[model samples]
Each structure stands twice: as structure tokens, then as C-alpha cells.
Target: MEKARAEAGWLMPKTSGYAACAKLRRRGDYKEGTMDFFDECEIKQSIQRIDELLGSGIFDRKHIGNVLYRSAFIDLLICLRDLMFKCRKFSEPIRFTDDVVVTDEIKHVSDLVKYVRDAVCHPDSDAHYLEPGNIRASLNVLYGKGTLIQTGDFNSVSEHDDDVCFFIGRQRIYLQRHIVRAFNEAKDKLLPLVEAASQKAIAESIAGIIR
Candidate 1:
């Protein structure tokens, strides 16, 4: 139910893009009788949707991944993909403004996000879905090592003592910590960069249409 509520922003344009843009135009929120006005408006609207989807999630997790802590984990990946993915409106490579060095940690986190995103969106099989894999991933991120579960033994996140990850009490804590770290890094360092770039994309798109 909470996830459904959070997805409301992403669903908005699909629900009301045409009518809302028309309404905006009538109100002079966009320049009247302009060539790029509507296109630019749409680009800004897309960026706004991305912003709304980035609303707060659990970042204060004292330990690692939990039932409730998954919001930030999932949302951050979606947000990163939006920023880095190619878009005609923004021709430049998405990057940091202050030039914060992309260290191994950042790169690893990025890779993990993509990996997790793929698993979520396109799993090969039900057995290969987000179960033991998620547990293993959390262990890898937090403990520097992870053990894989035998499918015959454990397959679900709820699967307990039979899981390879079941015995790792230390990892349960680490998993949440890793999640909190990833969420914080994206929020503190990456959010502003993407936001500035998104604004620039909207402005440039508008400029192109008008010129």
C-alpha cells in the first residue's frame, strides 16, 4: 500500500499529462504561442515526477535490510537510472557538480543498484527472483563476503534456518547499515547533481523549441 502511494508521482503524467499541460498553458505558466513551450513543459513535468518519486524513505536503519527499509533501497535505484539513462533533452553525461570523485564505493553501489534493478524487473525464474539473492547481496555489501544458498535448501526471503544466510546474525545488522549508507550517499551527494542537471535539461529543451 505504501509503495502504491509512493508510485503516485510516476503515474501522474500517464493520468493527466495532456489535460494538465493544457491547463498550464491556458494559465500562462508556459509561454503562449511558443514553438518549444509544450515540449519543454513536458520535460519539466517528467523531471518533477522523478523528484516526487524521490520522496523520503527509511535511512536511519540501525541495522541492514528489513521489511520496512526496502523503500529507500528500491527508490534510489529507480532515481539513479532516471538520471544516468540517455535522454534526448539532456545530451551531456550526468555527473557531479562539485566533481566529487567517484570512488570504488560509489561505483560498487552503482553496479549493485543495476544488478538489483535487473533482478527486480526481469528475473529468469521464480527461483531466481529476489530472495536468497537479496540476502546474499546484503551480505556481500555489508560483510565483504557472501555465501550462496542451495536452491533445494532455501529460496525465499522468509525462508529461515534452511538459508545459507540464516546463521549470519552479524549480516542481518550489516545489511541494514549498508542500505542506510547507500540511501544517504544518493540523497546527500547524487540527488543535487541530478536535480541540477534535470533543470538544465528542461531549460535547454525549452530553449531549443523556442529558438
Candidate 2:
């Protein structure tokens, strides 16, 4: 602590024992906001796994359930992606120019991600208001009709159980592929934005010191 203060040309203040040590460590390592880049990378990798599973064409209904549950991580990725964009614009002057408008696309994506997250996290119930059909609807919106088919009618349990499961698995794979593609595109765009922003901040700080 003394070394840090001295190097920065500030007076070192004494602190209490364990709490002070913990505080100093936290202060030294603190990030300004919730997003961690590494976690975002992990989410991207998970999205890739979803893609791989889709390509393998070997997953069953239970496997799809696991993927859907794991997709809660996508919400975190979306939050981090938005935060990174905001950080990029942090020092820029606010303006009302039409070109500078923020869109609801991210929010829409987040909402869908949230729906998937909820569906996976909680059991389907009358009170929770989750129907398998809702998941199918969300898949349709995210992936398009060609990739996702919504069937309102299924034959009796013993008659078409295998067919229903097979169809559901196929649709789940399609949904997974679409999600992976979307997240990858978002990541590709946002990473450069974050790097540019960080570089600009560093340049400005250096210029300030030189001045």
C-alpha cells in the first residue's frame, strides 16, 4: 500500500488490520462495472458448443434441456456486450444526431434470452405459465419458420412419442445454431469496439500526462 501511494506521489494512510488488507486488495483489483471480458469469452465458447451439438445431430430431448438450461449464460453475455458498447462511448459527447441512435435490438435479444433462461431454470407449471409451445414460438422468432416448425397437434402419447421427440430435438438444434451465429456476430463487432475504446482512453491519459 505504501509503495503504491509513494509511486503515485500520494501520502499513505494507515488502515486497520484484516479489513484494511482486504479493502486494499479489492481496491487494487476493482473493476468499475459488472462485466468481465473473460466471462464473456466463456459465454461465446459455450455458444460454440451449442453450435457443435447442433452439427453433431446426436442430441436427444434431455440434451436439449441441458443446453437450454445452460443458455442462461447468454443473458450475462448480452449484458456484457451492451456494457462494452456503453464504455466505448463513455467519453464521447452526447448528441441527438440520428446516426447516433441506440436501438432496441439488444433489448429484444435480451428478452428472448431471458425467456429461454427462465424456461430452463424453472419447471413448467400452470402458475409459471410455461408451455412447450411458448418455447417453440420463441424459437420461431429467433430462428425463422424454415428452421423451426410449430406443431399444435400431436397424436396420442404411445402413438407418436418417438416422432414428437425426434421433431423437438431437430428444432432445438436449429435454435441452437441460430443463437450461436447471433452471439458470434455480436462478439465480432463488440470486441473491436471495446479495444478501440480502451486504446482511446489510454491515449487521452497519456496526452494529459504529457501536457
Candidate 3:
């Protein structure tokens, strides 16, 4: 995660040329007033949905954590793709190749978010453990080493052997807390980017119509 931020800082430098061009194209058409207010409304609705989910106290921390991280990550990716498409930078794009992975920093974060989601959702799965070390390891794979540090301890067993039962009876409280914090932090980091991308895409689309 840290590595990704650093790389994004380095590679992205500013918004993509594609983004800039798209924004310019949209602004150019503002005189015609072709802006799709409906699309903007939809994006705002989606953002509101996420806000509600994050603010809701109904779900436990782990579940909410998974939802927040997954939703936020996906929202950003879709926003970027939408922006690209609206700007004509990406036309009828097909399957993304593995070699092209590093071109987009959001892709790396998406992968980490998936790994973390899987770890949290299926704690007993043979996949990567949800331990902090493992979480950091997964993030490092995509972003680079030292990008994320797993500061807390994730290994705590119950006194009674049977006490480590499913859902309710384990030491998941701590894990849930950690997951919530991570998701909240990730959401905070990603939301602004997503919003900007969405707005840019909408502006560009309107501009295209006006042109």
C-alpha cells in the first residue's frame, strides 16, 4: 500500500494526460450544456451508498471492513476506466494483460484489496493468512516492499480448545478492529481520487456531446 502510494506519486506525477485531455474536451462543450446530469447523479448516488454502508452500525467490523475496502477499490477502478473511456483514451478495451499491470497504480491497490478481502472473508482458507505479516506481504507483492507494515499481532488462541469456535466465540474482535481501521484508512485515501475521476469523466462526456 505504501509502495503503491510512492509509485503512484512517482509515475502518475499528476493526473494522466488522458484525464487532462478528457477534462479539457468536456469543458470545451460546456457552452452547449450537454452534460449528462443523470450520470453525475448516479455517481453521486453510488458514493452515497458507500457512505451509508460505512456509516451503518448494523454489520460487524470484519464484514463492514470487507465491504468498504472492496467497494472503495472497485469504485476507483471503475471510475478510472469510465474516465478513460469518456476521454477516448480507451476504446473498446479488451482483456487487460498481465504485463501491462504496472501501468495503472489502481490495479495494484485493487489486487491488494482483493487479497485482504479473501483473507478476511475466509479466515480458514488455504490462501494467505489474514495475519498482519501476510497482509503486508501481499501488499508488498503488488506495490513493493515496506509499502505497508503489519504492526499488530494477529496470533491469539483461546484458553479452551473449543472456545475458538466459529464467528461468535473467537478472538475475531481484534482482527475485526484491525480490518475496520484498514478499510477506513483505505477509503479515506481512495475516495477523493474516485470522485475527481468521476467528475472528470462526466465533464468529458458532456463536452463530447457539445462538440
Candidate 4:
């Protein structure tokens, strides 16, 4: 398994994603609220944190119960969405190696990420309400008929075995099948951009000193 993972580029990084940015931070070359600061601190750190979370088994329902797992899943979705937003702001068209069209109907992973995050964050706005004992309830988000739906009413959703699907707002999403794969592909594409930005910061610092 380790060999296969290494071959597949699934091995963890020797250093945190912030390693490239650490040089700038150490020299005080970039201050807070700057692009350099955001690149080294927010963008790089977020990718590293996502990597950690994906491997932590927290997203696995067997290891984590209903409420906590859903919370973690929603948080992951939010993080991915934020990362995409930052990437778009910092660098246009985050180039993915493969087609990231998550669903046959949805053209981009960003659409799903935004849709899920928005739905979870503002459920009331969409008239999606959690059940009375939401803290202990199992949830799942289902994509169907060109719309995403959440229902605490299990009978209304497709009958899925708990082992295969992750529960969120009475909907089921397959963790490895969707989230993890998309994250890995995204991280791979984003890392080079982060590294290039870090190098650019270093170059600017050198040029400033020369001037």
C-alpha cells in the first residue's frame, strides 16, 4: 500500500506546504495583509491542513459519529471553497491535471463546493431545516434531478448503506470517491503556483535591497 501510494504521489510532504513561504516570514520580508503574506500563510497553510485532515480519518464515519462527522465534512467543504476563492484571486484558472467536473451535470468542482458550503452555511435561507435532535442525527446531501437536496427524512432520500456514504444534513456523499480525490488533484495544481509566488516574493525582496 505504501509503495502504491508513493507511486501515485499520495505520500505526505517532508515539510508543511508553508515551507516555501517560511523564508519570507523569517526575514520579515512580507507583512500581514499582503499578497506574500496571504500566499505563504493562508494559501499554503490551508493546502497543508487539508492534506492532514484527509489523512486523519476524521471524515470516516466509522471513526467519527454522526454529528461530528457532518460538521467536519461541512468544514472541509468550506475550506475547499475558500481555497478555490483564494486561488482565483491570487491566480486565475487553477489548472487541474484532469477534468474536475465533479458530476455529469455540474461543469466544475467549484460549483459543487460552493453549492454545498452555501447550503450548509445558510440552510435556513433555503428552507432546509435540521431535525429536532440534529446533534445526534445522521445527515447526507444528495445530488439529483439537477439539484442538491438535504432531508432529515431518510425515507425521502435514496437508501444507502452507512459504510459507503457520508451523512450530512440528511444527505450522503462518498468521501474518497468525491472529496479526497478532488482535493488531491487541486493541491497538486495549486502547489506549483504557491511555490512560484514564494519565489517571486524572494526575488522582489532581493530587488528592493539592490535598489
Candidate 5:
């Protein structure tokens, strides 16, 4: 500690930490107000975050639930695709050496999401207020590295993450999880191909603008 303080040139005064903390608080020194970009109505009204928009009851909860839950599944694929698209934009198209692509499981989930979207969006609908606690969930998609996933221990799980779906609920509820092991394996294989492609694209773009 002393070495670190000396290295940083933070020569402590003879005064103790308690005295320093009290002095800083008396002057009202640290709490910055929220920035303008954030929506503050929820904070002001003391509305729960999900309740503020998704839970506000402007629309039916079942419809909202179906739409948002489906969106989580849809967005995962979209994010990876968009990231790859952006990476390829300023460079050449990305290529997977093994021709690995979205797994059958992911394709099914994608189709299911589309079906759910149609059901909820239609005026004569098929949406249901899916009892979140009642349904037995299964995993077909995962968002991170594959692990054992049973113990729920931090390190072991990190080392061997199994695919598991999570339903986040409050006023609004949605199902979320990562893609399957196949997806994770493909991502590991393909990221190298696009990583450089993205950098190359970015550099060329900046250079073109300057020229």
C-alpha cells in the first residue's frame, strides 16, 4: 500500500481517513446529477423501470410479454449478424472455413420468435400470458462459452458454461439465453476471420474520409 501510494505520489497527510471523509462530505463534493440523455421520468415518478414503459398498461400484458420475449431471441441473432455485417462493411465479406452457420436449434428458435411476433402483433391475436413460473424451460441457445452449468459456481461455470434460458420478470417478463455449443464453437472459429476484417474496414474508412 505504501509503495503504491509513493509510486502514485499520493503522499498521505498526517490527518486520518475519517477526518478526510467527513471534510469531503461537508462540502458536498461527489454526487453528480443524472445526464440529460437518460430518461429521468421513472426516477422522478418512482416508477419501476420495466413498469415505466413495458408495464405501463398502455397495451395488454400478454401482448407485451410475447412481443418482448420473442424479441430477445430475435435480437441475439440480429446482434451477431449486425456485428459481422459492420465488420465486413469496411472490408471483404467474412468467410467461415468449415461453412458452419446458424444451428438447426437456432433456426427453430428464430422461426418460433417470428411466429410469436405475428401472434402478438395481429389485432385478432394468439398471445398468452405465459405463466413464467409454471413453464419448464429448456436451452437451445446460449450467449457465452460452453460450461458444465450445473453447479452455478462462478469459476467452474465460467470454465464450462451450459446453455440455460432465463426469464427476467417484474412488470414485464422476457426469456433470454445464449446460443448453443455449436454457435459458440462457430463463433470461436469465425471471430478470427472477421476481427481483422473489421479493423481493416475501419482503417480504410477513416483513410478514405481524410483523403
Candidate 6:
């Protein structure tokens, strides 16, 4: 119940990247024909999908064993992976941004995103289709810490007493928190940087034409 409480605490209202960018576009905050414009738009679409899946009541404790829940969880993981792993188009821009400091927190969150992406993509190598000793060892490494059911061959997100864990299919990863944080990183940090760069490029192009 404590973990549940913790999970519930972070569900405050969040602005959608899609809506924010749409409003900005309507206001002509930046030019329309920039790569950053489309990149941010696409990234926001992924983030919005992630938010919808997480907040759609699919991960309720009652739905833990449901097939639909499993499918939705897989979808959530894929969305997260695609955002950070596949769609890191803004990383280089952020790296060169003079005003934005890429802090350790950002680094850690990115690392966790990559870890889950790898885990989801290569679960067989990590947990299944390996020798018994190897399998148990890998499971222990993944979801065993601070959990009662650390060394089994289960494949769902399970909670026993206070500990929540994933054996194969899902994750002990606090799915909501990780997904939200990643979404914020993209929406808050990377999106702005990209948008600024796009505006600058657009201004330079316009000035060159005027000159």
C-alpha cells in the first residue's frame, strides 16, 4: 500500500506537449518549416501516448494478470524505448546549448530509460532462454533487490506485501514514474532547446533574405 500511495502521489495535472506546441504554433512562437518543429511534434505524440497508456487504468492491481493489461504494459514500454532510445534527436542540440546544463539527474534518468529499453528489447538474454543458474542470477540482478520473490521465473509485475517486482514481462521499474520523468525530460528540457534552435535558424534565414 505504501508503494501504491507513492505511485498515486505523483499523478498531478501535466500539460501535454502536443497541446503546448500547438498553442505556440497558433501564436506563431516559432516558424513552421523547421526540423525542430516536426521533431518536437513527433516526440510529443509519443509522450502523449505514453501518458495515455499509463493513466488509462490498465496497471491497476486488479488488472495485473489480465491479458489486456499485459499488452498495454508492453505498449507502454515500447513507447518509452522509442522516445529515449530511438528518438533522441534532441540530445545533440541540448549538448551544445549554451544555456541548458545537462545535469546528473538528466544523465541518470536517461540511463534508466536505456536500461529498461534494453531489458524490454532483450528480455530473453537477460531472464529467459539461459541456463538455470544464469537465469536465476539475472533475475536476482533485475528484480530481486528488496523483494521477497527475487529468484523465480515469473513474467509479470507482482507485488508482495510492500515490494513490487517484475520477473520477465514487465518490470520492478516504477513504470509510471520512469515514464513520466522521461516524458518531462523530453517535453521540458529537450523540446524547448530544439524549439529555440529552430527559431534561431528561422530568424537567421529571414535576416539573410532581407539583407
Report every candidate's CA lDDT: 0.38, 0.37, 0.35, 0.54, 0.33, 0.49
> Taking the tens digit of each residue's C-alpha lDDT, what string does model 3 give over 1-211?
3233223221122545345334545676333433333334434454455456546542433453463554443343344333333322212222322221223422432333333444444536434434533442221111111212333553322223211111111112111222233344444444454566556655555555566
Which of candidates 3 and 4 reaches a greater lDDT?
4
Ranking by TM-score: 4, 6, 2, 1, 3, 5
Tell me how far candidate 5 lies from the true structure as C-alpha RMSD in angstroms. 19.0
C-alpha TM-scores of all predictions: 0.34, 0.36, 0.30, 0.57, 0.23, 0.50
Better model by lDDT, 1 or 4?
Answer: 4
Candidate 3 positional error at 42, Å? 12
How well is each residue in 84-105 modelled by candidate 2, as lDDT tens digits?
3443333221122221112352
**Model 6 poorest ten-residue lDDT run:** 93-102
For model 5, how does the per-residue alpha-carbon lDDT over 113-195 read when each residue is reduced to its tens digit?
33333443442432322334442222222223443233222211221233233221101111222223323333444445444
* Candidate No. with top TM-score: 4
Question: Under the 3 Å rule for N, CA and C atoms, how many clashes does model 5 have?
Answer: 10
Candidate 5 stretches with Cα past 4 Å from truth are 1-107, 126-201, 209-211
Candidate 3 lDDT: 0.35
Ranking by lDDT: 4, 6, 1, 2, 3, 5
Q: Output the lDDT of residue 158, model 1.
A: 24
TM-score of 5: 0.23
Give me candidate 1's TM-score against the actual structure.
0.34
lDDT of 5 at 95: 39
lDDT of 6 by residue, 1-89 (tens): 32231222211124443454455557765554444444644566777788888678766667676777656766776766666643355
* Model 2 bad stretches (over 4 Å): 1-110, 123-176
Q: List CA RMSD, all candidates.
A: 12.3, 11.3, 16.4, 10.4, 19.0, 13.7
| Off by more than 4 A, model 1 | 1-17, 20-57, 63-65, 86-89, 94-113, 123-211
